[model samples]
Structure formats: C-alpha cells, structure tokens
Target: TQVTCRNSLKNPLWSLIEIPIISSVTCQTVTGLIFFQNDFCARILLLELKWCVLCLLLNEAELQQRSPPSMISLAGGSPNPNTFPFLSASIQVKNGRTVTFDEATMKRALQYSASNGIPELVTWMKNLQKNLHNPPTASYSPEKGQMDMCVTTGSQEGLCKVFEMLVNPGDNVLLDAPTYSGTLTALRPLGCNLINVPSDQHGMIPAALKKVLSRWDPSEVHKPDSTAPKILYTIPNGGNPTGASMTAERKKEVYELARLYDMLIIEDDPYYFLQFEKVQRWLTSSVSVPFPWAPTFLSMDVDGRIIRTDSFSKILSSGLRIGFVTGPKPLVDRVVLHIQASTMHTSSFTQLMVSQLLHSWGQEGFLQHIDRVIEFYRKQRDAMLSSADKWLKDVAEWHSPSAGMFLWMKLRGVADTQQLIVEKALEKEVLLVPGGVFMINSSDPCPYVRAAFSLSTPEQIDEAFKRLSLLIKDAL
Candidate 1:
C-alpha cells in the first residue's frame, strides 16, 4: 500500500519546510509491535506483539467459563483439566502451615484465567491499596470508567508501558538523579530527551523540579499543545542504590509541583513494604491496612495524576514476577491493553497461588509475616553497618538505610569506582556494584558504590568490607 501526493508544490508552506514533509507515505500493516512502516523512519519498539491476536482470542476463551453455565467453552483452546497429571497441591510457608488446593481447585489453577489477573487476586490487591494508600479513585470499571488496575509480568514492564505510551522521539522526561540504573535502561533507548532533577536523602527535590520546568516552559520542549515534560518518574520509597525514602513533606511538595506544571507522576515503589524502622501495625478483620511509611504520591493524587508501580518481588517472591499498576482508569486501561497485546497476563497459576495464600493468611496474618521479614532484613542491615564501621569507616562514608537491601557508600578518596570495583574488587574476591553504573551518563566518573546486605551473612559482609577497605587503601 502506498500514499502518493501529487500536489506538493501547490501548498505554499511546503517550500519553507526544512525536512521532507510527508511527500510520500507508505501506509502498510506492520507485523507485531511496529506501529507503522514509513519510507523515512520505521518506529520499531522492543516488544513483540505479532502473535497478539492469539492472546486476545484466549482472553475471550478464558471468559467463557465465567459466562452463563448453559454455554460451553468450545471456542477456547484450553486443555482439559482432567488430563493433567497432578491430583492435588499443597504449599507450606515459613510459618509451618500448608495451603492445600483440593483436586477441583488444582484443576482450576491448571487452566487459563483473565488477562488482567485472577479476579479475586485483583480485588484483594485493590483492597490492599485502599487500606494502605487509599487514593481518591474507586474500583475498576472497564465499560464505564478506567480498568482501575492490572497485573504485569513485572513492575518494570508496567512502568515501561507507560514510557512507551507517553514518550515520543524527542519528548522531555524528568527523573531523579543517582536514580535506578534500570530506569535509565528503560528511558534511554526510547530516544526521549532525559532531564535529571537533583535529589537528596529525601528523594526528588521539588525546587529542582520547579527549576527544570521553569526552563522547559512547555514551549521549549518542542512538543505541541500540552506540557512538554509530561512525565516525572521517581522511586519514592527506599530508592534503588541510594535506599533513601522520601519524606511526606517532600511528596506533598512534589505533587504540588506536578499539578502546577501539568505533569503526571510515576511512582515506582518496589520496597514500600520493607521499611526497617517502622513497626508493622496489624490489620484488623475487616481488611483494613495501615502503613507507617511516608505518604505515597498515590495518596495525594486527587487529580488522578499519579501512576504507582508496585512489586511483589521484594515482599512475597521475586521469581513470581508479579506486580500491579494502580492509577487513573484511563492510563491504567491503556497499560492493560499493552499487557493484553504482549504477555497477555501474568501467570494465572501464580496469581491464583498468591491469592490463595493471602486468603488463608488474611490481612492480619499478612502483616505478621511482614513483621518477620522486616526483622530479618533489619538484622542484615545492622550486621552490614557494624561490619562497615569496623572495616571501612575511615575509608568510606555511607547513609544508613531506613528500608530495603542497599547501602550507598561514597569512597573517601576514590574519584571513580568503575575500574576499582569492576577490576580490583573482582580480584579481591569481593563483589559490590560501582556507582557509575547507576548514573545516567555511565562514562563519567562517580565516587559512589552500592553495598547490598540482602544475601551476605554477617561474617561474609565483614570479610567483604575488610577486602573493600584494602581495595580502597590500595587505590588511595
């Protein structure tokens, strides 16, 4: 298919245009995620969506069982559950309790489920959001309003979808500095102009955001109509590498700046449940949840301007690769559409498994489990801090993590950690991530290094720091 314009010279404004102004448009159907094909540029995305129709049809197939009982699921290609070899399944938790699924339930688990998520699991997640953050928005309504929320293969996928949905070739995007390395990977290849906002121990600086926007002024972004820097991405809770959570006041101020600049906030909070200092308050029988961490941007998003990406990787199980995107109906539904086209849905079996466990635990038991998890990590943090104090106190300085698994350390004399950690530390049998990897400009020198306390034993942490101290001394 081709679109040929015969009267290009007839338009007077075409003579002054610098670039070729749509002289010929190749209007062809592209396979998979390539939006369209053109002669000048082919906007190729990383996601493979060529087999999307099969998944879309499967979604309808899965819905058949939920439909009228009089209807049979002949349209579905789902395998018969009775043919499955497994009879029943039981999973035991650390608390020494087994959640058993009987034959019927096991059969259901073996089958396909909804695209968004298992309905019960999605509901449970929504209730958890209400109990914890309690945004101004209500439930999911696909026909009337937003899809409310949808589960993704991982939180990063959900976040990436938003980036794909909003950003164009030359659009400007705002993000906190010394940010997550994963964030840079997600945004960089999109060809969008990346603007770094200065941050402190309290997270993204509001004054800095205002300053960035003041220069942008919508017009300077080279975007049409609305605001130029439309998306502001941040990791508000237990920031990656830095491990610094935002103060409530900072969140309020940031939200205000977003409102003023007409920007949407994307709060990527994977460590929301892992705050070390806060004691877990038990949720009562009525499914109410209370968290002592700083106010989430979602809580302050009265205008439905905040889209929060949360993960089960930290709190529940990392391998599950399950996470939910919560925000305004419009944006969230768009994400769902992407999910439908790509992964179709998060694994229905995993979704049902997690949902079952939560059902058995209830809200109170869930918080109790979180209490144990926090205690375990707090001990790990303390062990690492103690080790650092004994070995590297004079060589490096670090901020105590209030939550999560990382401690950000700035070497006293080292100018760049790249060669030191990657080359020297590897030889020393000590492994720690160099800080330059997390920076937006990877080639630049960075003095910082991230020390993780998640997996190392106390003795291991102590020995690693001792070797790190030696590495530092040798460098100095």
Candidate 2:
C-alpha cells in the first residue's frame, strides 16, 4: 500500500551533452508488475493494461498536489443567504482590513473570573437569563447556591460535564429519539443506560413521556431511576434532525412535568438566535420582549431545574468554540469541578472577542446581525424547497423548517435512504447525509435524508438535486 515516486537527477542539458540528443521517446506500453507472497517462492505476474496510439505527452514534469476545491457543501446543517442577504454591509469589506481584538476588554473579561463565570459576563448572561426565564432575578439574589453561569467550549461540552457529574455508571438517562447525535456520542463512554422518548413536530410528546415515565420501575433491568430521570435533553429551537421548535405552551407543560418529576432539563439551543419565523423576529423586537432573548424553558422555570446551554457559534464564528451554561449554583458548582479538571476554562481571548463584538454592535446591532444570518438561511431554504418542488415534489416530501439550516426530506416510497446515499448518490458525486447517522439507534431504518443549503450556489444546488433525483429514480 505504498506509493513511490522516482525523480531523475541529471538535467536535460547535461543529458543531451553526455549522450545523443533525442527529440522525443515514445512509450509503446507502460507495464505495472505485481508480486504476491504465497506458498511458493513469491509468485510474480504482469498486470493487465492498454496503451493508446503514439502521441507526445508531457512527462517528468513538476506536479504539485493541491487541496480539494472548496465544495458545494450542501450536507452539514447550515443556512443559505442567497434568499435573504441581511449582512449586505459586513460581507463587502475592503482589502487590507485586519480584525482586531480588544485588549482592555480581554483583561476585564478574565480577572480570575467567578467560579461560575467572569462577573461581568455572568451579569450579562444573567440579564439574558432574566430575558428568557421570568423568575424573580432577586431570588437568584446576591448569594443563592445557584451557579449563575459557567462558560464552556460549547453546549456540547457543558452537556458532557453535566452528564459526568450527574450520572454514575449504569444510571438511566432519557433522550429524545433522533436526538442530537453529539449527545449520544459523548455519553456513550460514560456507560449510562439511555432511554429514547418518541416525539413529533411539537417535540417530545407529553403523552409519550408520561407513558414512559409511568412504566418505569427502579428494580427493573432497564429502568432509568427510582425517583425520576437525572436529565431530560431537548433542542427546543431548530432541533438537529427534526427541525422542531417547542411552543411556549409546550414549554410550560414540559416545565411542569420536570418540576413534578424532579428532573433537570438540558436546553441545548445554539440556534436560538436563528429563529426563522418572521413573526418571532417581530416578537423579539416588541417592547414586551423578556429575558434569555426569547421564551425558553429557563424563562418559564418557577423552579430552577433548567440547565440552559447557549452558544455563539451560530451567531459568531464556529472557530471561536465559545458557549455558556446557566443553572442553579449547586449544580453548576459540581460541573465546574469537572471543568476545573478537564479544560480549566474556555479561552479568555475567545470570550473577550465575543464580548467586544457585542459591545461594538450593541443590542440593536447584534439583532441586526442575527436577522442577516436568518435571512440568508431563509433564502437558502426557499431555493432548496423550490428546487425540490420542481424536481422532487412527488419523489420526496419535507416539512418547511421554522428555524435552522436543514431540510429533512423523506424520500417517498424509499425505505432506506442510507443505502441510496452511500451506495448510489455518493457514487454519482452527489453527497447527502442519510437519516440513520442522526439516530440514537443505528439499526432503525429512516426513510429520510438531510440536505443543507448553507454553502452551495443556486446552479450547484440545481445540479446536486438533479443528480439526487436521478439516483432516487434509479433506486425505484
């Protein structure tokens, strides 16, 4: 499995001077020999090949390997902006402009920081908390055992640290089916028993949860808990694979359920800022708008059971890898112990950059930037949907996403999207993610595939779809 390249040492001029100069050398045939080590003294054979008619072809030339071209990446969960270009100004910067970081802001944002998070960032986060969760901010008060906020690499890290603290090996945890794949991947090594609850467009069905919880017995082999679940995970805004957003009423219902059962809710909402509904944007702008920026599980918590995980990746750059978690101090304190042992603290530089960016943009500017991003995705979604309607209306069906950057297309009458994607579409140079990749249980067949419009151009989008349509047709 090794490739060797041989380069000749003599220069062309030197070779001509030493020997008779030749105009060109014709290679009648190129032979590749293969040797196999077997029972006998290593058998050798001539490999099969074909050579074309005489023609002068360049050879022994300097060939450099280049990285693959930046692709029409219509596979990951992302937003496309061709439909709505919100940041018309930002993307049109002049040359030679450098991005600068705030030094004073960095020092201020650091300063040993509180156990929960830096005091100022904590204050900023708490203000967001108040906006999202309407609990008396006074109750969290000057010194309630609540961890105001703890910054982590991102929500995924926060979820991991929380799981490490709350779950012992063999303990039971409940996850929604087709949950965020990262959550399952992270928790697998912890050896906790996972139970997946069934869900629909509104998110984890209350009736299904009630049934699952009622049937649970502590002494049973696969039972989760004698009391209640250690944690209940959900992505309320623009959930990963399903793209379901939980309504305020549903949030209240889930909150009450969590309160009655004494379980914590891990609200992993990276896409909170990316809410797609034009109405939600107007609501966010209204004078009556409240904390955490929108109606969140944390906002509705009369009891502090919601461990809210928020990220800057969707709004800011993903490379920053910055996010924060807010919850009761005792729980956050335990999580900090894990953070102290693991990553210590998220990069102060990263936190400061985001803080400074926010300071410069102000609340209005921040909202404007988010709108720009959302609008971009909105356009991308429309383009993809339009293409689907024209090319795949009968072959595929999908729900128009209310938020986030994916189209969860269920191919009509196609039982296995995985095979179609892996064995067929990929061979034709059109890539798509099969639904099975996002499932908690891999054995299950999902008649769905995820398409992303965040990075592909309109023409490329059409071509990719055409290729996909042909592949699906061939499958039928």
* Candidate 2 lDDT tens digits, 1-476: 22122221321100010111122223343332211111000100000001111122211110101213553433223233233323212221123332353444434333333334444555666665555455542265322323367788877788888776655556567777767778889888977778888876767777777777776542332122243465788888777887777777777877777655556688888878777775432224455332223478876665556777888887777888878887765456556656755676676556655665565665665666776788888888889888888889879987787777777888988997988898888789988889887787776888988888778987788889999888888888
On lDDT, the leading prediction is 1
Error of 2 at 422 (Å): 2.1
| Displacement of the residue 354 alpha carbon in candidate 2, Å | 1.3
Least accurate stretch of 10 residues (summed lDDT) in model 1?
33-42
What range of 10 consecutive residues in model 2 has the weakest lDDT sum? 40-49
Cα error of candidate 1 at position 382, Å: 1.3
TM-score for every candidate vs. truth? 0.84, 0.72
